[model samples]
Target chain A: MGKSIESILKKYDNCSRDSLISLLQEIQENEGFLSEEAIVKTGKKLKIPTSKIYGVATFYNQFRFEPTGKYHVMVCRGTACHVLGSLTVLQELEKVLKIKAGQTTRDGLFSIEVVACMGACGLAPVININGSFYANVTAESIKEIIESYRKKEE
Target chain B: MSIQIEVNGKKLEAFEGETILTALKRNGIRVPTLCHMNDFIPSGACRLCVVEIVGNPRLVSSCSFPVSDGMKILTNSPRVIESRKTIIELLLSNHPDDCLYCIRNNNCELQSLAKEYHVIERRIHGNKNSFKLDHSSTSIVRDPEKCILCGRCVRVCEETIGVSAIEYINRGSKTLIGTTMQKGLNTSSCVNCGQCIMVCPTGALTEKNQTHMVQDALQQKDKTLVVQYAPSISVSIAEEFGMAPGTDINGLLNAALRKMGFKYVFDTTFGADLTIMEEASELIQRITEGKTLPMFTSCCPAWVKYIEEFAPDFIDNLSTCKSPQQMTGAVIKSYFAEQSNLKPEDIISVSIMPCTAKKFEMQRETMGRNGVKDVDIAITTRELIELIHLHGIDMKTIQPEITDSPMGVRSSAGKIFGATGGVMEAALRTAYKKITGEELVDFKINAVRGFEGRKEAKIKINDDLEVGVAVISGLGNVRALLDEIRNGKNDVHFIEVMTCPGGCVAGGGQRIGVDRSFIEARTKSLYDIDDRETIKVSHKNPEIIELYDNYFGHPLSHKSHELLHTCYMERDVLL
Candidate 1:
């Protein structure tokens, strides 16, 4: 947010507004997600409106507004997962976290998001935490799986 | 180059690269279009303007398809008509069946298209999307269920006004136009310009109705309801009653307001006069002191907010003079209060503006005194028409009367404030006199007129001094102008920026379809008033001169500063 990001902003100073997406990607790569300050500074450097930048950013699922929590939870909502009753598993996680999908927990220890597909249909009704995929997840097993992530955060 | 094209068995002449829709329209051939805005590039999103080509297997969108030599197009063939009917039926599949209670019932584009297509019954029924109504923004109210996703609002907000406050989120069936991160519009860099409302085909976006609040105040016995209307409102409000465009109904409006139970109906045009005085003084002070060059006019709330949010570095360059509406409201709450021995809270000040941003402007923290807001409510000209009809008062039957006394009198300069270059024209009229003890040669400054995105003029005040002024109505134009100024390409000392294109005369709250002709008519009406009045300068207004001589003492005086001036602060665009 200080001198560290100013140099990154300067790199894109010569870039045109069409380069907004790549610039946002570079910033998001450096930072976990697009912070409020990063977006504003990128807008200034690129000479693009922040609203326009946000619009372009929101178009891609890769760009997240909030930083991922200590442990990121992804529930598969693809056809395979849905057939295997992943909706109940996702619901259980939402109920326990007291936050819906696309929201971070109040403590910032965990975040939940619904992914369209993880591309592993064989391992149906899956939940992934911190890049580790957990297969055959059930409504009841969701508690222990989330507990493991919370324990890791601790 | 002219190109020959056949439309429905008739040969038509069209420009070489012209769109099929444009060609058909020029020849008086009708094509039903919802997403197609007159000034904007073709979106081809509506799929309602599909035309059958001679060789093409599928129907092509006439709006996006170009005219080629020897191209045969059937505008209303049975197949094309069938496709359009299906498009209309699909659009109505998810649209709410509440047109009777909708704000844009009769004026709704989709409803009219439905009427034309004879979509009496819903042929294709689907899942109705349940979206939370966004009343978070002070000015605009967004109802997602009513939105047809035509992308007209998105295009106008992004491409025209340079305020891309709302965008298309998600994809395919799940898509809906929303602010970044799906947050409420209040959190976004929405200047509350209401330009989106102007472009929206449905009642999806509308000005937050304050007419009920105004109506409630009118009923209250103890509360003194004082109403003021912007100069633009008088010229455009006539459109609601089927009158000719650019009609001056100020006198009739004053009489109607009195009939509707307004104890005092003062013209905000007088406030525009006061604005010219303070704004001219501010401009003179800036040039003389060389502090903030290219001082932007702060009369437009949306433009003021644009500076505050996007261009905070140039916030100091904004004129400190309160807008005419706010100035009039401040005067009503202060001088009017003192003269009438009425408490500030006891009096309710409402203004009928040709702007939706005025609704948001009334609620600004800086626009208040002693915890009492200057303007209680700001309703658009459309709302005023509704209130007039609700009260069962006809303007034609009423006697033409002048605006109420002490705050009523305004000059021709103030009248032009509704038009695009009117502010700069009025400011120069007075700024010329203030700089060198001489009036401008002629009141009409031709250089700073018309619908060009940006108008610039260099006025040689005398041998030593010259005032370089520029006026732009659209924020998109202002962005380019600002960049030019930053690059040292433009040495303009003063700039007047209005958020909505064509200034307040074609403001977001003016009417539904804001095409070029209506704007010209409205701008001409303002100039006509400016030309008709004997007092062409703000400083020459006898009431304003008396106001200074008695109460304020002078422009930029301590008393004047307290009520007629304000400041700006930086704002966050996103969370």
Candidate 2:
């Protein structure tokens, strides 16, 4: 819907349907998240149905439909994190942020997303907020992390 | 190349590139399958078709596994049986336990497979999925709890209907088939074709039942119940009555409707004839006047809705004639009611169609007059059969009866409106006469008479004018043709598009578990009637002629336009 999205689509002019994912990735990379208009436009560019585009986008957790909040929180649910009881920490983050994974809070200040892996598996129960990593996070530490983010926002 | 394969220790001949399922089917060996649809690419999503192969440790899904020379397959060995039973049990683990009251109770493929495999008790217990029932669409009801996630509906919607209104959303354990943005189907690009319902293996999809409304109307003493059945219903409804496929029980159907307390019964074929009168004349006018060149037939509601939403650019090209069902409903409330000395408001006009989309079409904004719908309700062929059963009218014992007088007569041309290419053939019959001032020597146009995805024929009217026509069924086949038309391919003058393959005879509202042969039989029956009948063109029907003479002066006349035609607009959807 934006001029940047249009420029990204222009690069894939006359491209076959096989270029759909890369095209979608480029749009999402520039737009932060895919909008309904973006998906519809991508479908038109790729000669695919919007329902199929949505299906593909929803299948991959990397593609989010909503824009990120001011403080984007990423909770790792990787294999190592799961074994280290990060599920409680993820739930605690969701509760503290008042939003589910891949959703933003109503205040537009905090958002939560769960990642498969952060590649820092050594930090088992890891939580990343705005590119800064918090290692070995517990349910109690989730509130403190949120409180620090709220203080920064204030 | 032909190759030898051993099935259950017996040697048999099979094609080199053929699947093991095909090889086994050719040898008359039955293997239970769920995710496999005939003539469709096998996804092997459901492993129920797994069979044992000698010297192979892993069991292979015969539907997707290609047969090779010296391949020894055991279709029903102990291991294969156990694997199939386990698959059915696992599918039932998360499935709802309401098969007794489900719409597809006995006809469901999943329930049949479970019974065949003898899945007595739940071997694997899991939490039942809690999916909200989607009753958002006027034509279809989606119950996700009963969905087996076999992806047949998803495939049929995409590959067959070419309207991927739904797809598998999310990944792994969270995956479920849904429309765009996880919204209801009403907001999606769904055309309400109901082909997904035909392919759904479980009770996940069914027509929105309207039998209760028909019953309620029957009980109303003040309502004058007037009914009309589509051309395909007589031939297709016989299968539900234990009669042979393609059986012509038109007289019996009329008698049953009358027995069910209907004040009058009519045939929508009469309306089909009326449609041909208007449609063919509209085509001739368009061609001569140099208006829209490739005029698309607007008989199939699903096709109409598809063009409205998916191909809005072609909205002007669509013939403005109301479909045979809607035309009949309009005529019933106006002309027929007037003839019977009744008011339109007192008439409860109902239509029986071989389509679920008609249920949606009846509710369209333009399909009514003065806030009174042309049709009070539209029931499918299946619902009509149910109503007969509910009224305790024995179809076998009921005497064959004729339709109500004055407006009930139909020619064989109208009767053939059930099959693919039927509208084209019917319209051509009358259009030929109207143009050349003489009847066609050979009424049957063989070029447009088959089950091909697309059929094209150039009809010669005079020395200078040759009208090219195209007939295609299944919405999937229209995309390429539409693209070509957009690219300025100007040969085709008229196009008849039916949403379901093989047309209304094999519509979504017809019986389940029917194959291509059944459809062929129904089509053959319609053709057989056309061959035997004297009145084979819509213009020859005395009733239609009389209607024009008495009320509507001519085809596309001012009065006719007010009742028999409507306009379409660009319908907005999520893409």
- Candidate 2 per-residue C-alpha lDDT over B283-395 given as tens digits, one digit per residue, 9 for 90 to 100: 99998899987999999999999999999999999999999988998998888888888989999988998899999999999997997789999998878878888889888
Worst 10 residues of 2 chain B by lDDT: B122-131
List each model's interface RMSD: 2.8, 0.8
lDDT over C-alpha atoms for residue B429 of model 2: 94
Candidate 2 per-residue lDDT over residues A16-98, each given as its tens digit: 88998888888888888888889988888888889999999899988989888988899999999999988999888888777
State the weakest 10-residue window (summed lDDT) of model 1 chain B. B166-175
Candidate 1's displacement at residue A3, Å, is 14
* Candidate 2 chain B superposition, TM-score: 0.99
Name the regions of candidate 1 deviating beyond 4 angstroms: A1-38, A66-71, A77-100, A105-110, A114-119, A125-154
Model 1, span B440-494: residue lDDT tens: 8788899988888889889888898888989997888888888787788656889
Q: For residue B433, give model 1's deviation from the true position in Å.
A: 2.5
